[model samples]
Target: MIWDLFVLIFYFLVVFYFGFHFAKNTQKEDDFYLAKKEIHWVFLLLSLVATETSSLTFLSIPSLSYKGDFRFLEIAIGYIFGRTIVALFLLPSYFSGNTISVYEYVGNRFGKSPQKTLSFVFTISRLLGDGIRLYVSSLPIAFLMERMGISISPEILGIIALSILSFVTIIYSVFGGFRAIVFTDVLQWIIYIFGGIFALGLIVNQIGTTTLLEQIQHLETLGKWKVFVFDYNQTGDNSYFILFAIIGGAFISIGSHGTDLMLVQRVIATKNLVSGQKILIGSGIVVFFQFLLFLCIGSLLYVFYEGKSIPPDKVFSHFIISEVPSPFLGILVAAILASAMSTLSSTINSLSLTWARDWEMDKWFSPRILSLFFGVLLFFASLIPYFLVETWEKGILEMGLTIFSYTLGPSIAVFFLAKDKQNLPISGFVFSLFFLFSIVITVAIGIGWKLSFTLLVPIGFGCLYGLVSLSRFLKKN
Candidate 1:
């Protein structure tokens, strides 16, 4: 236990050192938010991966495979396709101007009213979505503390864990800004990937390679290895039907990668358009492989436990606490922290940047102060999940994705409208947003209809686009 604590302390110190080191160079607005537009492609690529990975990816992805099969990969395939579209179609407009907020593209076309409206929606959705992410990140920490014989209630422990993470993430984000985040993200990426590899190695060592192969073969007999879903009948009941998964995944990627400022900021930070495009497309491929690694880890865990029943969300963390050795256990915990903090810091910085640029909050406060403020807001937001845990039944990944789906579709729809040669009417844009939200809210509350969370983005995109187009046609006639 002492050695484990030492490892964690050391990790924190190293991250802190990087934060303060970058603070000296972050003297300007561009330096703070866009990293002076000087970051290398490799760093940007890894940072983009780390920011999106979150603890949700580290924890919840394996759970998906543990509970089901590899059908989730279909969504990942869709991610690649979606990013490719962003690179080809949407990115050109972003690069055409020197605007700070991506919504400025909308502002330039339609007006500031729609631009700020989209930014506001993005801010709210990002906060709620990442609040859930913050809560999910705290779970392993709380679980680890409990295993270490801490006598506190899990709820209090979760808050403590969340506070510690938020503080460390806020410090660097406030001081070092986006550059610091990109650098630390590279480090965090290494730690978590290594941790995943280490865990996989140990599992293989215990199972014996030959027996592992035999066991996998046996598991395959039970359809555990199934990946593609071809049956259309399963569309309503299954989220991973290949067609739905791919289309939904693609739209989700478009919303997340193309429109969300958290990621768009990364693309904007790259040295040039080509560099940005490289990382955007490359990240999808890297993520597909990353998901495969974790999914395989979950499948093997299933084999290791001889198919014993375990809650999918708890499977990986439970295994680490029960089976992993001491110093390595601490290292894996740090790995989880690495994943969590990377996303948290990025969230703080992006939220700060968006508020400062989009809402003109910089006039009232410095960027660092805004960073501090949002960090506090996010910490409080993250705490809400603890009270609602009994009611929210979806896994962390699905819930986080659902929260994102709410605003992502409308946001992406606006961007699609912005790309057209004809300018969309502000009234039409406003009406479409209303229509999109009403349907999503109704579907979300389980009011007389059922839909897979995956379908939300496409539904939102179609609704918003269709309404805006109709309004445009009426105006033309």
Candidate 2:
């Protein structure tokens, strides 16, 4: 208990220092928003890397790898296709706006309704995402400890850990702004990718040099990394599912990079379009390997727990609890904090930026006042950790990502068609509205209908016709 509590105290002190350290750098709204567009490709790469590898993925990848090394390879194949599309289409769209709220571009292309509607979706979706991660991250760690005879309530630990962590993140974010978020994330990213890899190496060394290679061979023999679907003829999980993973991965990448404000906000800090593109392309490359590295760690865990009784999510935790030495435990905690900080800081900063600009609340209150307003709201909001956990477990997470199909898809479609052109007619809203309505109806009918037809049927036909007519009408001019 003392060792663990000491670690917690140490984390709070360090994180608080970074938060206050960066607070001075954030002066104007621009600094708060995009770090004054002063970020470099290296940091941007790290920031992007850390953001994509959330704690959930960190916890589960190893779990899946441990349970069946094959699953790691299977799922990572989907990420490859997703990252490819993100590098190509999504990166460009974000720079086109280079402004607050990626959805503002939707308003420019489509209309006001689409922009407001999409922002609401992004905000709510992001809350669910950040909330879910914030609530659950500490729980997994606590569970691992109890198995080692360290009794602790996950619920209590989650609140305590999250509150302090969230407070630390909120400093750079809510107070210092994007500079604090991205720059600190760049620094912290080192502890994670490197520390995680080093831990894997230590474990491998402990097992024998061939341990990793043997596991990979074992996983391959079981067909773990196969790209095609599990049950091809099921119609639901058919061969075409890879196509879905690929296509959906492509579109979803755009939805996140192009539409989601958290990521889009990060790109605005680039030196220019060229630098931004460099970061995107560079980060995409890093992600391919990063996923492999973590998944390898997971696969090794799969080998480690060949006959043990433990949850898949608990594999990495088990390793940390039982294997990691004390001095380096602080190092591991640093990695965990880095992962947690990357997500929390980005979310809080983005949330503050959204409120200040979109609500035009800035006109009424000073930045200090606005920051206080957001801090109070989020602090109270964090109290309902159960709702976040329930929503995440109940599939609200994937749905939140799915909802982006409405705003981001049309925005990209419009951008593709509307380049070097004048204002789109008010009828552009018709297409946007169609996409929104289709997604809403699909979500309302429930997840199955969404998976089946929400996107492909209505918005597909509606946007095709809208763009075709739009092109003809432009030619007549």
> Where's the lowest-lDDT run of ten residues in candidate 2?
452-461
Model 1: which ten-residue window has the lowest total lDDT? 441-450
- lDDT against the true structure, per candidate, is 0.85, 0.60
Cα lDDT tens digits, model 2, 274-324, are 676666656656766766777778766666766788766556867876777
RMSD of candidate 2 to the truth, in angstroms, is 4.5
Candidate 2 has a TM-score of 0.81
Could you tell me the TM-score of candidate 1? 0.96
Q: Write the per-residue lDDT of candidate 1 for residues 401-420, one digit (tens) a residue.
A: 87787677878878887888
Model 2 local distance difference test score = 0.60
For each candidate, give its TM-score against the true structure: 0.96, 0.81
Which parts of model 2 have CA positions greater than 4 angstroms off? 1-11, 68-98, 144-152, 210-216, 225-231, 235-240, 366-435, 444-446, 449-477
